[model samples]
Each structure stands twice: as C-alpha cells, then as structure tokens.
Target chain A: MGIVNVKKDNFEDVVLKSKEKVLVDFNADWCGPCRMLRPILDEIASERSNVKIVSINIDDEEDLAMKYGVSSIPCLVLFDGGKEVNRSVGLIPKDAVIEFIGE
Target chain B: MYDIIIVGAGPSGLTAAIYGRRANKKVLVLEALSYGGQIINTLKIENYPAAPNISGFDFATTLYNQVKDLGTDIKFEKVIEIKDGIEKEVITTKGSYKSKTIILATGCENRKLGIDREEELIGRGVSYCATCDGGFYKDKDVAVVGGGNTALEDALYLCDVANKVYLIHRRDEFRGEEGLVDKLKEKNNIEFVYNSNVTKLNGDDKLSSVIVTDKEGNDKEIMISGLFIAVGKIPENENFRKLINLDDSGYIIAPENCHTNVEGIFVCGDARVKEVRQLVTAASDGAISATEAIRYINERK
Candidate 1:
C-alpha cells in the first residue's frame, strides 16, 4: 500500500491505534530535504507489508509537531503499540532508516 | 548474493557503479539523501576536468542518468548497519540484502555551530545548505558562519539573492582561496564579522536574529531572517563503525587504495580519512575501490 497522509483527526486510528508498527514522517512542502526524502519513504512503504507509513505536514499540524518535539524536517518517528520506539533526524540512507526501526 | 553493494549515490558511488556494472557484476547503489551529494549545493564547478564550466546540478543529473541507463540498481535508503561475513549483509531501513563486497561512499555532512536552539531551528530559518534554502530569504537579511571556502562561497552566492549578507568568521583571516576572498570583499552588501562566534539564536517561532560574540566577550545582535552554517563538514560513518576502522574524527580509516580494515569491505569518497577530499579525488577513489572489489570477487571465484 502507498503512504497515508496523517492529520489531527485520524492521528489516533492511523498511528496510535494501529495494529502494526507505524512510521510517522514529520515534513513540510518547503523543506528541500523533506522533498528529497519523500520517494524513499514511499519505497519503504511499498516494500514493508506489515509496517504502516504515514506523513504529517508540519505546517498544517503545528500542534502535533510541538507535541512530538519535532524541530527538524524529514524526522522519522517509529511507533509500536501506541508508543514511540525510535526516531531519527535529518536526511539518512534507507539502511539507516531500517536500523532505526530496529529488528 | 550480489557482487557489490555501494552505499551512497554521490559522484564516488555513482562512478563506482559505472565501473562495477560495465564489468558485468551485479551492483546496487543505496543513497540516503539526494543522489548528487554535497556537489549539488555548489552553484558552479569549473575545476572538474572536461566540463569547462557547468552547474553542479547539471553535472550530478548527467552522471546519475548515465548510471541509471547502465542497469545498475539505485535505491534510496538509509543504511543502518553492515555485517561482515563471507557474504556481507547490508541492512537498510527498507530491507536487508547480501553481497560479496561492499563499497562505502557515504560523504560528510555540514558541521553544526553547537549553539542552543540550533537543532531546534532547522528549516525554521537555520540551514546548513545555502543553495537549497537561500531562495527563502530572497531580499531579506541573512548571516553565514564560517571562514572557509564553503562559507565564502555561500556568502557570495547569497549576495545576489539576500538583501544583506553577514559573513561571520571566528578568525580574522579567511581560509578560502585568495581569489574568492577578493571577490567577496568587493561585494557592497556583504559584511564580514570576523573574530566572533554565533553564540545564540533569538526567535520563538523562527529565527529572527543572531547574537555573535567576539573573543573579548562582547556580543552583537544582528537582525536576520536566515542563518546559513558553512563552518565545515563531518563524515557520517557512525553506522559502519563496527564493520570498518575509523579515525578519531569519525572518518573511515582508509588511508589509501580504498582498502579498509575488513578484507572485502572498501571505502571511498569524503567518508574515508584522506589528505584531500574533492570531487576528482572522490571519483578516483571510486574507480580504485571498484577495481579492487572486482579483483577480490574474481579471486574468490
């Protein structure tokens, strides 16, 4: 499946209440690195059948960004069982992203 | 298993892919960021041979297309770790794969100023790359921190876009070439802030001003909409620390010939510890590393 666009209303059902692990990408349109990172995230979503990939626009979701302490673009936060298990900042390679997700 | 898994799609990694694929070996290139590496940030590249004068963006695009047409697989993935064995295992954020040899070409990233709110202000007016985000501050005041070639180049590039550019350097003397320094001095809108460090960033939602401190403990607040940090670059080799040897500065310890501590693992580009880190050198290293990798695979067979 393709990546899901996450927002305030579906934050609970899409991310927090999901059965499988969820990867939340905090990004914005103007962020250059974030734009570069989009295709990579989509590739990951296509490869992983069980993991759910979602993106939250920081400009539109300032409250959620503040709640997660997201100060940077292209930030990937991994959630498992409704809790944050891991996260990474800046532009990184795919292997690094998988390692950040843990085994 | 595949023949080679090249990490990073910069000039070096792409160059290596060209060689590896031509040799009829199965090759895959994994890149974390954009395919161009640091060269994409450069506006013009005259030093690269045969190119005469070409924009870095065009150069990178041309090279990338060449590699793509060669049937070499290029994947955009963040590499998490590498496991060295008879068949090396490359673990990425997307998935894991095994290859007979691995070539590391992951380049360096911009160094941070280490000031408070610096990390928190990224994209919110604090940027390390001028070419990527300079347009956001068009006709607005901005500051660049560094005395090196990168910093000087950034300031000169911003002079045409930003209304005013503040070049902040900790030393009175610049480390860049004299030619560029002279050109920077000629710009009327560019102001040099020497012998000072950007100690603080002031703004709640975004960066509004910066407090630069001199060696004598004096601080001056400069109003600006953006801060371009070009102090220097550091190798992003933390992931391969377990599989390869690194220097004190975290650079992969491959003094020469792209030979790493591991038998089948090779390193190239800016990530390796070397005296010179340039586009040509990186491309040369890629050629050498791929050649050596091909030799290793043939010998094993």
Candidate 2:
C-alpha cells in the first residue's frame, strides 16, 4: 500500500480509527530532515502491509500538531489504536524505523 | 571478510567507502541512524570548497549515490560493540560482520540542557534543530542556549520567524565565528544573554518559561514558547570505549592520521578529537583514514 497523506478531513478515520497499526509522520515542507525521511517512509509503506503509514503536514494542520504536542518536524508517532503508543523524534534510518514499529 | 567495515555513514564514512572501493577493496558501511549524519538537517552549506550554496540534503544524497555506485555495501544497522583483533568484528543491533580494517566514523549528537523536565518537554517546547522546529514557534518568543556556531546559527534563523529571540550562553564571549556574531548583533529581535545558564524549565504540559542563572547566581525567568538547545555535541564513541582510547570528552583519541590506538582500527569525523570539526575537514579525515587502513592491510598481507 502507498503512504497516506492525512489532513483534518481523514485524520480520524485513517489514523485514529484504523484497525491496523498506524505510523503517523508529523512533518513540514521546509524541514530538511522531513524531506530526507519521505523516501524512507515510502520504502517502508511499499514493503509493509500490516501497518499503515500516514504523513501529516503540520503547516496545513496546525490544530492537529498542537493537539499531539508535536513541536518537532519529522516526528514519528506510532498509534496502535486511537492513542499514541510510541514516538521517535527527528530523522532515523529504515532499520530504526522498522525496529520502532516492531517495538 | 570484507577489506574494510566503516561504522557510521556520514560524510566521513561515505567518503571512506568511496576511497576504499576505488582501491578495489571490499567495503561495507554500517550506519545506526540515517545516512548524512547532522549535515542532513542543515539548510545550506556555504563553505565546503566547490560545493558552495548547495543544500545539505542534496550534497548528502549525491555523495550517498556516489558511494552506492562504487559498489559499496551500506547497511542501516546501529553498531553496538567492536571486538578488536587481527580481523575486527563489528557488532550491530541486528547482526555482526568481520573486516580486515574498521573505520570508526560515528559522529556526535545534540547535547541536552540537562535541566529539569527537559527530556519530557521535547516536541512540546524543547528542540535541537531550529530549521526543523522553528516553524512551530512562528511569531512566538523563543530562546536558544549555546555559544557555538550551531547555537548562533539557530538564533539567527529563529530571529526571522520568532517574535523575539534570546541567545543565552554560559560564557560572556561566543565561540562561534565573529561574522556570525556580528550578524546576530544586527538583528533587532535577537537579545544576547551572556554569562548565564538555563537552570530550570517551567510549565507542566508545555514550556512557558525558563529560569536562567547568571554568573552572580541571580536567577531570572524568561517567558518563551520554544527553547532551541544547541549547546554543543557529544561524541557517539561510548560503544567503542572498551576497544579504543577516548579523550576526556569521549571523542576518539586519534591524531590527524586518524589512527586509533588499536593497530587496524581507525577513527574519523566528529567522533575524533579535532580542533576544527567542519565538513571539509571530515572529508579530509575520511581520505586519510582510508589510506591508512589500506596501507595497514597491505603491510599485513
């Protein structure tokens, strides 16, 4: 499955209410690390079928970023259900990303 | 076994890979985090000889591709331990590999404030990279702590986006370039807080204010929506402390030749003790370390 670009409209259904484990990437266009992370996330999305990957542009959705207290870009928050289970800040490698999701 | 196994795929390690492969040696680069190291977060790299005005991401990607095209094997596994012997064993989080020579290029990481609730406040009010998190504090008051080039650069960048910027340093003088300090002085929105250190972080859910203690032990509170900490960097050489010699600050004790105390193990980049830790110097170290490793391998053969 392809990575999902989430906004306020589908954030609830695509991330919070999803049956599968979700990895929501909080990012911005101007962020260099966020740009570096895009291809890696795409690779993960293509390889993994059990987990759902989504990207949320904080600039477009300020309210959602604030609600999640994500002051940092390229922040990866893993959601098992409707709640945030684990999070990793800043840019990380593909293996680290997989380990994060597995944990 | 591979001829060389480079730990960390930053500029230094990647450059070493290019050199190692060009010499027809089998090379493998194991990186814990993403390739490119700290340079990826940088917006623009003005210095670095011919690569002027190039974005850090572009530079890193080009170099990464160059290394890949050279037939160097790059793995995304964090090196956990290194067993020193004739054939060095490099152990990572996932698995292990044996090599004739090893290059320790594990770079440094952001130094934390070590203040109360600082860890919990990350992504709420505390940030390490201004370029990545400055947008969140747009038009909001922010404070940057540190006296190095990174801190000065962060303050300058934040001044454009933040309503007000407080550049706080523990010393009266800044260790960054004079040109950067001059540029910061011209910004009306940037305030220099010297001879002071952030002693406490205030707020429950998020940061609201920080208490700074001056040289005279006077405590003052500065209200801000964000705090960008760029004090300095700490070397990632703790894993190899048992196998290599490190200086007082934990940087690998390697001279300009990038030769570690161990016979075949070499160190390079920000992980090594150096006077100047710039991108160009890192590339220089990469070349030197690779050449040294090649010579060592040939002599043993």
Candidate 3:
C-alpha cells in the first residue's frame, strides 16, 4: 500500500505541479465511512509513488470543498497536469482505486 | 426553405424533429452548436421513467441520433434573432433561414457566480448539476449556498451522495418548500448556518475551502471539497425579448401547448414556463411544438 499524506498547505504543489498523477481524497476523520476508505487510499498512495494522494479534513478546509463543488464525501478526483481528468465518489473497494491508477 | 425549422437541439428540439419528420414535413433543426445542449453536462438522471440511471450526456446523444435516424436535417449554426410576420425568418451569424413555421427550443443558461475565480473552475471543482458530478465526491465535504426550495433540495440530495453538506444562506431565513425543509432537518449529515455569505474561494489548484463571514461580521472558514450553488437560474431570452411574449422572470410564455403570440412560431423546454423541466417534459414539449408547427404550415401553405 502506497499512500502519501497531503496537507492543506502543499495541496496545490502536489496535485497540480507533480509529473505523476494526483488523487485527492476529500474526507474527514469524524466521518465513520470516511475512516473505512482512508486506509484504502493510503495503500494506493504508497504502492504508487508516481501519484500523489492527499486526504483533506472538510472541517478545517472548507475552501477546498466549495472549489470542487464537493457536495459529497469521499470524492476522489484523478488529475494529470493540474487538470481534472477522472473522478469517483462514495466508498468502494481498495481495488477500485488500483483499477483507477493502473500502476 | 424547409417546412419546419426548430431552434435549439436539446431534448425539446430533437424530440420535435422526431414528430415533425414523421408528419412528412421538411424538418430542419438549426442548432447553435453541436447536438445536445446543456443536458450534456448532466451526469445522471434517475427521475427519467424506465431509465433507472441514464446519464445526461448519453441520453442527449441517443436522442440526437434518434432524430437523425428519422431523416431530420441538422445544421450547426447559432441563431441570433427571428422575425415574425406573414413570413417568418430566423437570422443566424452566417445568413438568414426562412421557414413557414418555427419552433423555438432555446434553453436557459445557469445564472453565473459573477465571482473572479468562479468562472475558472466551472468544470474543475465548480459545477451546477448534482446528478452529473455527485459520484465523484464520495467521502468529501461540500457546501451549498441559497435559501430557496432548490437550495434545500440540493442539500438533501447531496446528503445521500456527499459525505457532509453545509447549508449557507445570506438571510436569516429560508424560502424553500415547507415539506422539504422538514425533510432536510431529519437528516443528521446536514449543517445549517444562517446569515452567512460566501466571500471568497481559496485554493490554487482545485478547491481547498471557502471563506465566509457571518451576519455579525465574524469571519469563519468551512473546509470542504465540492460546492453546489443553487441560488437561481437565469433564462436565456435576450434574443427573443422583442420577438415574443415573456413572463415576469424573462421566460417565454406559451398559451396552451406550444403556441406563442406569433402566427407560425412555437416554444418548448426550459425557456418556457412549466411545472417541470425534465428530459421527458422537454421531449413532450418538443413533440407538441412540432405538431403545432406542422399543422400551421399546412394551413398557411
């Protein structure tokens, strides 16, 4: 499992500037379901260092939520050059993320 | 000049073509751009009967192809203006196209954010339709600003799709449907904040969060990933402002089915006032307008 921690401070540089693919996991710890999905994302991040994985706490970073129109939790946006290319919502199996990245 | 010319290629326009061509009329569909109007932006449509989960883009494409199969002619040109009289003509950027009957199906565009960076993130993080992009935000937090029935309804819909939903309003009260508000409060995932205004969006790439100030002039930051703005939608009736009769909210007014004040002109879809503006209803309106236009053409010619 390869997962990298993405903070609010370095969200842009990691998601937009990185040569590798970027995946943003919009979530918070308080959410019970979010907890179930966090580890899945973490594993994907570690397995694939080429992609940047970031977990966001909606409680502290409301700005990011509104920017992407993240009306739902567990929204994962796959980006390749700062531009959003693909996205998935709700909780699914860890294999789903792996299938998405295809590393 | 064709026997029937319908403006707009959305559900209404394409549906009209299906009926008009079946009536043996020379149906000419003059679309402003490619086939499929704003419906292409929609992600999913559950309310459409028999179609458990049809996407807006796919459904639009299918509808367009269906019209084509019926031998309805299509043109990719934007119609600028229309002149109504004993002879009806539509003015486009290239040249004018005249027809005995015209069915106006030009739909409405969503009211803009009017903010600086809001336009930059239209499809990136900023969106208007939940059925289209809701799945992309599974365990993420999102905020919705507005105080109408649509706003509250959006908050409720997002609750099932999104992780957290923040309901923000500029006024102390909300003006949504009574039953919907009661239904929204029952959900534990929703957070209601009153007298709050969204001042700015803060994020370099996608969206990190938003900066909002409460009524008391206190600043607070709400962190979330998706933002759904259900404030209000503006009708695109500027081109037809002088051509037809409009309601108070600037929507085209049809008397009964698709009949306008003009002799050979008709309208359908979101541009006209109706109870619902779903794909089915738009298609229904298109059919009605085409029938009306075909009959009028037969009588006039």
Candidate 4:
C-alpha cells in the first residue's frame, strides 16, 4: 500500500517483517533536513512497495528509539526479518537510497 | 497593531523578539515564569560565540535589557492558550491579548522521575536540574541519572562541587558526544555505573540515598545526600495542543521556516521537533522564525 505511520504500537509488525524489504527513516517534522528529505522518501516509496519506506518520529516513541540505539536523526535503517541489516545517518541523495535498495 | 508577539522569554523567545523588534515590528513578549526560563539555573554558558565565559543568568539578563532598550513590550504572565484567527492571538492568565502574528518559543520542561515520592521529595533532596541545585550538595555525595548530553553535562558540572558523583546509565556508552565522555572521566570525583537504571529514592526530610537496578535485574541501595535526574525532557506543548499539529512526541510540527499549520503561528526552540537540541540551535531557530515571521505577516497585509 502506502507509507504506514510507525508507532510504539505497530512498530514491530510493520518495520520488522513483510513480503518486501523495509527502509525506516527516523525523523522529526521540525527538523529542517527532515523536511528536505521527505519528498525524496515519498517518491521512493510511491515507486516501490518492494521497499517499504517508514518514517519514525523519535519524539513519539522514545523508548522504541532507545531500543534501536538511535541517538541522532535523520537516521535510515533497513530491516528484514525483524532485524536491522544496514543503517545510514544524516541526509543523502535519493539516488543513494535507490542504490541502497538495489533498484 | 503590533507586528509580532513572541510567547515565552527564554533564549529562543528573547532572540526572536530581538529580531522581530529590530525588523520594525511592534513586539510584545509574554512570559509566565521569570524571563530567562531554564537559563536562570545555568551557571555558565561558554558556547554562544563571542562571549567565551558568561553565566547564563548574566547573559540572559543582558539580552533582557537589550530587548527592553529596543522598546519591546514584555508582559510577565502565563499564556493559558492561543486563539488562531485571521491573525493569531494569545490569551494570558491575566487577560486577553491580540497580535498580528504569534511566535511560540516556549521551551521544554524536564521529564520527572515518574516514581512515587519523587514529587514530595523534590526540593527536599531529589532534583532534575544540577546547576540549580548542585550547589546545595557541595562537598557531599550526589547521584545523576541518564546518559544523554544533558545528563553527562550535569554530571560534569556537579563534579566541580560535589565530593563524589555517581553517574548512572542503562547503557554502557553515552548518547552524548565522545569529547564530553572523556572530559567527565578525567574528573576524579566522577564514577560511572553502566547498564543500570534508577529504581527508587530513599530519603527523609532533607536528603538520603537511592535504589538502582542493574541490567541483571538486581536492585541495590546506595547512600547519597542528593539525587539529580537528567534523563531527558518532554516538550511543553500541552497548552498549544489544540492550536497546532503536534507529532506523536507532542512536539509541534513546524515547517522548515518554523511556520506551523495555522497561519500567523510559528513554533521555535525545544517545543518543536529537531535533530540537534543544543542551545545554539535553539537560538538559530529563533532567528529564523523572526525573519520568516516578518515575511509571513507582510504577505498577508
């Protein structure tokens, strides 16, 4: 479908596993770079459901962040089978993400 | 009508007022508590470029005087709520007030321990701010919880006065900068206990000790005269909840220019979500909000 708003309630089911690879973007609405990076993420998510793009707001689920060892944003983590396989911190080009998912 | 009204008079609010007033806007600042907000409790602020060594209280006083000299209208009263109209308005606990545009610079409050007796024991012994109360524990043993930048910074600040400081954290590694970790370790008075959480506070009328649970689920009591909880903070967005679109963390959703969903309403500082929650960054947000607020007010006119 589309990007699912991940919360403490459903973080496990969505980010953990699905038929497709998941890319989780941990960001805050007030962050300037997060705004700049939003459209790129939306574009990528719209193109490929094989790669689910989920944005996590640390302010909402601080405990989930503590569990994930996230100290900074915008942090992008890739998950498969309930485990984080890769992660990148700060903002990057959309092409970089496209390459990340091997698209 | 005034061009802008900035709520809260902390660094962000004051700085925003300065820019707004300088931009030729008739600005009024509404403050609930004392003007400086949390800065009054700060002992020293070495980071705000140019002034290498300045007490937060003194620096804030200087800012206060500067804004006042510029003829900024300041009202010392709590803002109960904000009414968003064609032009946003802010109502105080005292009376009703209106503005052409409003900037929300209200900062965050320290998160409480949430444990029983913590509130009753507050001021008696338990505290969240080290700079505010660390002086009382001079030459005595004290405890600081959390591993964030604030926690580490407070622990380091307490190291100067307290004879011994016990820095407790649930993680072995700190979430703060590496340089700070090294600095705190150099202090002979600082001792670190990793993979542990604060369970409870054991105290009498004045001050006493604390109970901590290790990662292994073992809990133990340690004798101490003071306890400081620097774990973290939650944004003070409850007041403006109905007026703005706050994300899950209760932080107001301000765009890149600090403009919220409602017209003529802007949010800055700790009340909004941000990647870096440093003092300098908050000051920058204030500056940005002012420039953008001018443009916003002008566009509507």
By the DockQ metric, which is better: model 2 or model 3?
2
DockQ for all candidate structures vs. native: 0.14, 0.72, 0.04, 0.01
lDDT, candidate 1, B1-301, per-residue tens: 7899999999999999999999999999998767989886565788999996777667787999999999999887789999999989999988998999999999988899999999878867898877666766778999999988889989998999999999999999999999999999899999999999999999996899999999999999999989999989999898788778899999998767898999999998999988889999999999999999999999999
TM-score of 1: 0.75
Q: For residue B189, what is the lDDT in candidate 1? A: 100
Best by the lDDT measure:
2
Candidate 2 C-alpha lDDT tens digits along B105-153: 9989888878779888888789998887898898999999999898998
Q: After superposing candidate 1, which stretches have Cα over 4 Å from the reference?
A: A1-103
Give the per-residue lDDT of model 4 (tens digit) for B112-180. 878878866665667776765665577889999988888998999899999999999989999998999
Give residue A62's lDDT in candidate 1 (0 to 100). Answer: 78
Task: Kindly give the stretch of ten consecutive residues in candidate 3 chain B with the minimal lDDT sum.
Answer: B123-132
List each model's interface RMSD: 5.1, 1.4, 13.1, 16.5
For residue A30, model 3's alpha carbon misses the true position, in angstroms, by 29
Candidate 3: what lDDT? Answer: 0.77
- Give the better candidate number (1 or 2) by lDDT: 2
Comparison by DockQ, 3 against 4, better one? 3
Model 3 Cα lDDT, one tens digit per residue, B1-301: 7788899988889999999999999888887545667666545677778886776656876888889999988886778999986768888876788788889888877675666687655545566656445555777898888888768877888899888989989997788888998999899899987898888887775767888889789988999777777787777778888979999988899955889888788999888888777778888898888888888888866
> Scored by Cα lDDT, where does model 4 land?
0.80
lDDT by residue (tens digit), candidate 2, A1-103:
9987899989999998999999999988767788889999999999999999999999899999988988887899999989999998878878789999994
